[model samples]
Target: MTIDTALPVAAVMAAVPVRDAAVAKRFYERLLGATPDDSPMPGLRQWNLGDGVLQVMVDPERAGGGLATLMLDDLAAAAEGVRVRGVSLDIAQGEVVTAVARVVDPDGNAITLVQA
Candidate 1:
């Protein structure tokens, strides 16, 4: 079997589902160490990272069902930055990546950081 297709995605905006926007925003703000760069609609908040965006949206039934991974040049520094901002995460060695750490938002959504 053969198929021809094209994915011309210019950029990506990951949507993180949450139960409470306010609470989730606060948690993400600290974890990312900045306020949201945009909010396109109610119950939604976004942060621009590099060439992409990460957004949190309110969805009670879908809360805690989101996950995103971020690759960084310095995993230790990134982990330390979040920790100092009041987000607790533990770093560990992994085969796929040099170092990795994970943190969960108040609503249970997780964001994984890895050394690239």
Candidate 2:
């Protein structure tokens, strides 16, 4: 007769729209350092981003680019890791332990990696 209020929160996926699924897939693969889960639908790709999946969907009419944010263990390290792969990154001035680095995908969507 007890409730499980102690259950931790989890993130499954963050669906993002792209102009071209292939391009998006390549972008994410390079950024995340792994291939994504292919879909039979032919217009979507899902990359496994740790506890969650990042879905790159094809939708030409999709708006609101550069609108996704992600929190990571070490933002600076994560950004540096990806930077070596030739990814253009932007970091905001703040505490090193609590900094944010924004990275843009080929589709122009921005995802922020924060240190916390």
Candidate 3:
């Protein structure tokens, strides 16, 4: 399969903004079930997810405004795992998918887990 685009695309990464790196790190650590894989630069934490990466960046101006929906094979198990790790997310039925769990990070950035 090929995608048509005006500009060529190589790799993709996502950035989630937060007010404080320390606070954000803690929340993501639990939510993701591990510490960041890399901190390539100051004020930025990166996690390699499959072929992509997710970055938690310190940007107060954009904090609480970023959103991302992650694909999950088992939303129920994943939600329970995170909950046991001390992170809480609300699970609900979705119109386009089987189910979805929504969570707001320490800085309020929205993270949704979708089961398809």
Q: Which segments of candidate 1 are over 4 A away from where they belong?
A: 1-4
Which tens-of-lDDT digit does each residue in 3-107 have in candidate 1? 758887898888899999899989999998999999999999999998889989999999998999877899888778988998888999999899999888888
Please give the RMSD to the true structure for each candidate, in Å: 2.5, 3.1, 2.8
Question: What would the TM-scores of all predictions be?
Answer: 0.92, 0.77, 0.89
Rank candidates, TM-score, best first: 1, 3, 2
TM-score of 2: 0.77
Instruction: Please tell me which predicted candidate would have the highest lDDT against the true structure.
Output: 3
Number of clashes found in candidate 1? 0
What is the lDDT of every predicted structure here? 0.89, 0.74, 0.91
The 10 consecutive residues of candidate 1 with the worst lDDT sum are 1-10
lDDT string for model 3 (68-98, tens) is 7788899999999999999887889999999
TM-score, candidate 1, is 0.92
Superposed Cα deviation of residue 107, candidate 2 (Å) = 2.9
For candidate 1, list the clashing residue pairs, or say none: none
User: Candidate 2 — worst ten consecutive residues by lDDT sum?
Assistant: 62-71
lDDT of 2 by residue, 1-116 (tens): 98789867677678778887677777877787778766747787776667877778888788236466677887778777787876767767667546787777777787777777
Which is the leading candidate under TM-score? 1
Cα distance off (Å), candidate 2, residue 53:
1.4
